[model samples]
Target: MNCHQAYEALQGLIDNSLNKKELVEIKTHVRNCPACKAEYRALKMVAEGLDRMPLYETSPGFNKEVFRRLGLEYKPQRRPAWQSLAMAAGLSLSVFWLTALAAALPTLLMGAKAYKLTQWLHHPELILPSFQSAILKSGLAAYQTLGFAAKVAGWLLKSSALPTQMAVAGLLALVLVFITMRFFRPQTSL
Candidate 1:
C-alpha cells in the first residue's frame, strides 16, 4: 500500500481494529516507509501519553458552594448527561459552521479577481491597440487596474468578514454565559 493509504489506516492498525491480513499489509507499508513509520510512532506516543494521564477531582465543598450561590437546596435530580452533551454539541456545531463559512473567503476573492481580470481584458480601448508597444502598454495598464481593483475588492471582503467574525464571537460568548448560568447558576435553596 502507498503512504497515503498507510497513513489513513495507521490509526486502525495501531488500535488493532483491522483483521490480521489488513494489519499485516499496513505493517509492511510502515516498515518500508520511514516517514510513515515515524509519523505513526509520534501519534502513538501522543495517544499513550494522553491515556497515561491521571484524572483530577474537584475540591471538596465545590458542589455545596455552587448550590449555595444558586440558592438551590440539593434535591437529587435525574442525570444531567443531556445538558453536558447539548453544550458540547452546540459548541461543535457552531465551530463547524463558522469554519465552513470562513473557508469560503479565499474562493470568493479568487472569483472576484477572475471576473475583474476578464472585464479588464475585454475593455474596448484595450482591444484597439494596433502596435506591439501599444498592446504592451494596454496590457500593463490592465494589469495595474486589475491589481487596484483586486486590492479594493479584498479590502471590502475583509471588512465584510469582520462583522461575521464578531457575530460568531458574540454567539460563542453568549453560549458560554448560558452554559455557566445553567451549570453553575446559584441554587434556589441553601
Candidate 2:
C-alpha cells in the first residue's frame, strides 16, 4: 500500500476494525513511510487520551432540571366540558342560519327582478352576447400566445439533431439528480 492508502486506513487500524490482510498492508506502509508513521502516532495518542479520560455521572432528575431551566416542560391544561358544548351549539346555529338563507335565495331574487329573470331564462340568447363577447376576446388572446409557443416547440422537435440533444440532456439531468440525492441522503447505520 502507498502512503495515501495507509493514511486512509489509519483510522480503521487505530480502531482495530481492519481485517488481517488490510492490517498487514497498512502496517507495512506506515512503517516504511515516515509521514504516515507520524500521522498514525498522533492519531493513536489522541485515541488513547480519549480512552483514558474519566466518565462523569449525573444526579437523579438532572434531565428534568435541565429541561425546566430551558423552559421545555409540558404542562397540561384542563377545560370544562360546558365550554366545549357551548362552542358546538354556537357553530350548529350558525350553520343552520346559513343553510336557511341559501334555501330562500331564489325566492328573494325572484321578488326583486322577476321580469328580467324570466325573460333571460326564456330567451337564453339574450344572456349570450353580454357574457360571450368578453370571454371570446380573452380566449382568442390566450389562443394566439399559446399557438406561438406551440409552433416554436414544434420547430425544435422537428430538427434532425433534436433526438440526440434530448438524449444528452436527459442523461445529464439523471446524473445531476443522482448526485443531488446522494449528497442529501440521510445517514443511517445498518
Q: What is the C-alpha RMSD of each candidate to the true structure, in Å?
A: 20.2, 21.7
Model 2 ranges with Cα > 4 A deviation: 60-190
Mind giving the per-residue lDDT tens digits that candidate 1 earns over 28-135?
988988999999999899889988766556665788778989998965456589887776766654454344334334434575565455564444555564675455
Q: Residues 48-139, candidate 2, lDDT per residue (tens digit)?
A: 99987654556656777778899998454556787666556555444433333333244344653643454333344455675765554444
lDDT of each: 0.62, 0.59
Best by lDDT: 1
Using alpha carbons, what is the TM-score of model 1?
Answer: 0.33
Q: Estimate each model's TM-score.
A: 0.33, 0.32
lDDT of 1 at 53: 66
- The C-alpha local distance difference test score for the whole of candidate 1 amounts to 0.62
